[model samples]
Target: MDTITLWELVALAGAATLVGFSKTAVSGANTVSLAIFAAVLPARESTGILLPLLIVGDMFAVRAYRRHADWATLVRLFPAVAAGVVAGTVFMLWADDAAVRTSIGVILLVMASITVWRRRTAGQQAREQKGQGEEEGRGEPAGEGRQRARLKAGSYGVLGGFTTMVANAGGPVMSMYLLSAGFRKLGFLGTSAWFFLIVNVAKVPFSVGLGLIDRHSLLLDAGLALCVVPGAFLGRAVVDRINQRLFERLVIAATVVGGLQLLLR
Candidate 1:
């Protein structure tokens, strides 16, 4: 680990706060924290150091939104997520830091594009449905919806698991998945909180075995964890002030910028 400077400490503290805020309030905004951590520490080491703080944030989130979680969605995602975690672990064992960074960046950018495109198409479909005076499921086949939902679960679950295992960058991918599934504000936050808390806790053993988490890393986390308290509180306090569309746009924009930074760096 590199020696932490004053500015780096400040940056890390800010990043930790963002982790908490993203957990409770903005779902995908923690890509900024990932970027900041990568900038301040070695790429792999940064992921290790960030994990504990994220867990702390996750706890806050789970507490705030535990009631609103969609267990059905979680059940659908877990098996595929496990597969992705195994794949990511294999990749991590072989890949260098640069490869990890570049791959995560590309994935983020691509996912963002896909998300934007999906939203546009969904909007068009909504307009057509409105024109026909049809309710959401009036004409669509139930089987088709079920199939699409399953496909979404598998695809996003795998991607989310892999990205999170490799780069702590799964938030945006999962956010995109949840948004496309028509989650409302509380449902989105609650479901996301539980998902990350469970997934991140599961990653601890992997991280330790990979030599990513240690006493030193935990010490660093201890300091930064304090920052998360205020951030989580603020997020809970003000989350209702922000609407869904604005939140989604902000998440998308941040994900894009974070990806570009990683790619260019």
Candidate 2:
């Protein structure tokens, strides 16, 4: 902690504040925080320092949106996420910093592209349906819907687990999943709040096994975690004012930026 320069400390505090804000208002914006921390600290150690701050943010998010969680969806995702987390831990032990960063960056970009394409396709379909005055066939067949939902939950849950375990970069991926699932503001926040709170907490023992959390890291976190409180409050204050469309756009934009940052950094 003492080795960190003043500017670095300020940057971390700012990023920590964004952590709080991201939890409550914009879910994906903390990719910026992730990038900033990785730049200021050792990439591997950055994940450790950031984890506690995220858990703190998660606590607040859960408290605010606990009732809105989609427990069924969470149930479907947990097993896959657990598998992914284990795979991610193994990968972390095997891969170096560059490999981890580059791989995660590529994954983020690909996920973002897929999400954009899905949104466009869905929009076009909606337009065509409206133009044709065909509302009866708007929803997919029940079987098809179930199949698609399973596919999405499995794919996204695993990826969310892998990326978050490796670099704490799961927010964008999960945002894509939730957005594609057609979650609204409160529901989105609520489900994600519980999803991450549980996933991150479950990751604690593995993180410790990896030596990612320790006394020094905890001390550093204690210094920085307080900033997250104000940011959370600020997010809650303005979140209701943000409309659905704007919220989606913000999430997508942040995801793109986060992917780009990782790829280029």
Candidate 3:
């Protein structure tokens, strides 16, 4: 940890700032931060170093968008997420985690495809409803809609927990979930902020037991956390200007990029 050069620190500071930007703006964009950190430090050590920085970013995100959170969504996810976290802990006991990472990457790509299909289907349904007129058209059955939501919450929640625990890659997974559920920008950001802040903080004990977080990592985090503040402000300043369509496109694009990186790495 002590051997990082001046240029390396510069790189880390920049990455740290992007951590905050990602938390507030486009959630999946922090895969860039993940890549930067991996390049600068040992991959394993980088995960530990980056976790605290992410928490700092999460704090700022929650403060800015806390009121917009969807509590019902959070409630639906926690149980499944907890189970996945435990599974991830066992995965860490394995000698190699390559298979798990590959599986997550593949799942991410599949989820992205599903989200696209769902959006198109919904748009088509909306158009058909408009053409059919209000009296003839009907909404989705409440029971069916509830069932689908539960299924999605379970699957995405487990995947989100496992990927986050294993690789700090949960953001893209959860972002896809939020987008699929038709959450608007502030709601997406707010729910995500609270979700990750809680999950990441919860992972601390496991990370410590795994020897991934320690005094040295915290020391590095202290310096890097400062960079996140500026990025948070930058994201907040520009978020309102981003129309919903563009925001969703950027989230999906980042999710795909993150998935490809994980798959190809």
- Those runs of model 2 whose alpha carbons end farther than 4 Å from true positions after fitting are 107-143, 243-265
Q: Report the C-alpha lDDT of model 3 over 158-196, residue by residue, as the tens digit.
A: 988987887687876787677556565566778889999
How would you encode candidate 1's per-residue C-alpha lDDT over 80-190 as one tens digit per residue? 998888888888887788887788677778767876776676675555445443222123322457888798889999989998998888886887677666665577778
- In candidate 3, residue 251 scores what lDDT? 57
Give per-residue CA lDDT, model 2, range 135-200, as digits (tens). 221222234477778888899899889989988888877876775665555667888999999999
lDDT of each: 0.81, 0.79, 0.76
Candidate 1 total steric clashes:
0
* Model 3 score (lDDT): 0.76
Best by TM-score: 1
Best by lDDT: 1
Q: Which stretches of candidate 3 lie over 4 Å from their true place?
A: 95-143, 242-265
Q: Once model 1 is optimally superposed onto the true structure by TM-score, how far is the C-alpha of residue 264 displaced, in angstroms?
A: 2.9
Q: Where is the poorest 10-residue window by lDDT in model 3?
A: 133-142
Question: Against the hidden reference, what TM-scores do the models get?
Answer: 0.86, 0.83, 0.79
